[model samples]
Target: MIDLHLIGIGTGNPDHLTRAAIAAMNAADLILLPRKGDAKSDLIDLRRTICADVLTGATRVVEFDLPERDTSAPYLGAVEQWHDAIAAVWRGKIAQHLPDGGRLALLVWGDPSLYDSTLRIADRLRADGLAMTVTVEPGVTSLQALTAAHAIPLNMVGAPVLITTGRRLRAGGWPAGVDTIAVMLDGDCAFQTLDAPGIEISWGAYLGMAHQALVAGALAEVAIEIIEARASLRERHGWIMDIYLLRRAVPVA
Candidate 1:
């Protein structure tokens, strides 16, 4: 049985690598890194830098082409197909490199359990009759980076926080029971669709990196500011990974 490790490397920050994640990387017989093409080559470079900085052993580092989901298909369906393709790639790599079961590691952008499909793809291998054991080394998430960049608490005192995607927020609007919302995977400023007048937004782009940009103010006031910031950052960097926090501004008594 192959022992697999999914190590999370937080938001492109080399310092965000936990001791356990470093240990996992050094311990692996093979480490797989994915390339997402030229537009976002920085992501690929970041993973390479992390590997160079951390691996002390002879762990073989391998690079793989990440499969892009077909946009024409429905979102969920495309994602499912994409995961299957990624799993196929993984199976090929393991078979070619380690025909005999051994320790393997893959660096995930963030904690695999949160909004990542690495674990889900790993399951496909098991279903395909490959004997394997999986372990996860959690790392800092974008949500953490977002809050840290903004210097704000993730949640208000004793209040719930709804962590969701741009699509859901655009479709559902502000959910009930929680004034605090952490929006992730939001390509479009979904908050623009909200009727939230008294809401406040703290937005960050390229978080945890040198070119980090942040904008914060009342939602109605800075909504366009964030939109423009996001567009400009994407153009400058060729890619942007951003997240934002929203809450109803507390009225002074």
Candidate 2:
């Protein structure tokens, strides 16, 4: 049986790795790294750096080319297809590298339970009859990084906080009954779709990394600034992962 460990590495910063994460990496017999093409080479490089920093044994490392998801297809269907392809790749890699059973690990970006699909993909492996047990090591999420960077609390006094994606915020607008919202995977800066008034935003890009950037202000004032900055950063780095928190001003009783 292959013991699969999905270890969260936390926003590409080696310093953010937890003790459990380090132990799992060292205990693994093989670690698989996924390369998402030239544009995102830096992401894979970060994983490699984490491994180099923590690994202290004869653990083997392997890199595989990740299959690209089709953007033109319907989002759900496309994601399902992509996950299947990825699971196939993982199956092949594990079979090739570990014909007999062994321990394997994947360094997940941020915490896997948040917005990541690694667990779902691992489920696919189990469905395929792969004899493997899974273990998870939690690490800091981008949400935590964003809040810590801005020195702000995630929620207001006794208030609820909604964590969502850029697509949902754009499609549904601000969720009712919640003053705070944390948005992720927002390539389009979906905050622009909101009414903007009475909303404060704390935005951070490349959080916990060397090239981190932060911006905060009334949404009306900084919306355009954020759009421009995001575009410029993506142009310079060829990719960017950012998260932002928005809080609508609560009226005085």
Candidate 3:
């Protein structure tokens, strides 16, 4: 049986790695890292750096070519096919590296439970009738990183926080009953669609990395500024992973 460990390395910062994560990596027989391309090479590099810094044993490190998701197809359909293709790659890697059942580890960005599909891909292996065990070691999420970087609480006292994406926020605006919203995977900066007055925004790009950038102010005032900064940052870095928190102004009692 293959013992697969999905360890969350936390937003590309080695410093964010937990003791349990380090222990899991060291205990694994093989660690798999996927290369996403030049623009996103920093991601794989961060995993490598983490391995180099913490892995102190004969644990083998393997690099794999990541299959790009075909976006031409419908969103759900494309994601399904992409997950299947990734499962095939995982199968090949496992068979080639460990003909006999052995422990393997994959470093996931942020937390696997949040927005990431690594667990889903792992589940595909089970559907394919492969006998393997999956275990998750959670790490810091981008939501936590963004909030901590800004030194702000995730929500107001006794209030709720809605965690969503740029697409939903744009398509459905902000949800009711919650003044605080955390958005991820928002390449389009959906906050611009909000014409709501007195909305406050705390936006951060490349959170927890060396080139991290943060901007906060009233949404109406800094919406344009955020757009310009995001564009400039993406142009310079070639890729950007950003998240933002939105809060509607509440009147004083």
Name the top TM-score candidate. Answer: 2
For model 1, the run of ten residues with the poorest summed lDDT:
244-253
All candidates in order of TM-score, best leading: 2, 3, 1
Candidates 2 and 3 compared: the better one by lDDT is 2
Q: Give the TM-score of each candidate.
A: 0.97, 0.99, 0.98
Q: Model 3, range 14-66, lDDT digits (tens) per residue?
A: 99999999999999999999999999887888888999999999999999999
The per-model lDDT (C-alpha) reads 0.91, 0.95, 0.93
The sequence of per-residue lDDT tens digits that candidate 2 reaches over residues 4-121 is 9999999988999999999999999999999999999899999988888899999999999999999999999999999999999999999999999899999999999999999999
Stretches of candidate 3 off by over 4 Å are none
Better structure of 1 and 2 per TM-score: 2
Instruction: Sort by lDDT, best first.
Output: 2, 3, 1
Q: Which candidate achieves the best lDDT against the true structure? A: 2
Worst 10 residues of 3 by lDDT: 39-48
Residue 183 local lDDT, model 2: 96
Residue-level error in angstroms, candidate 3, position 233:
1.0
Off by over 4 Å in 1: 250-253
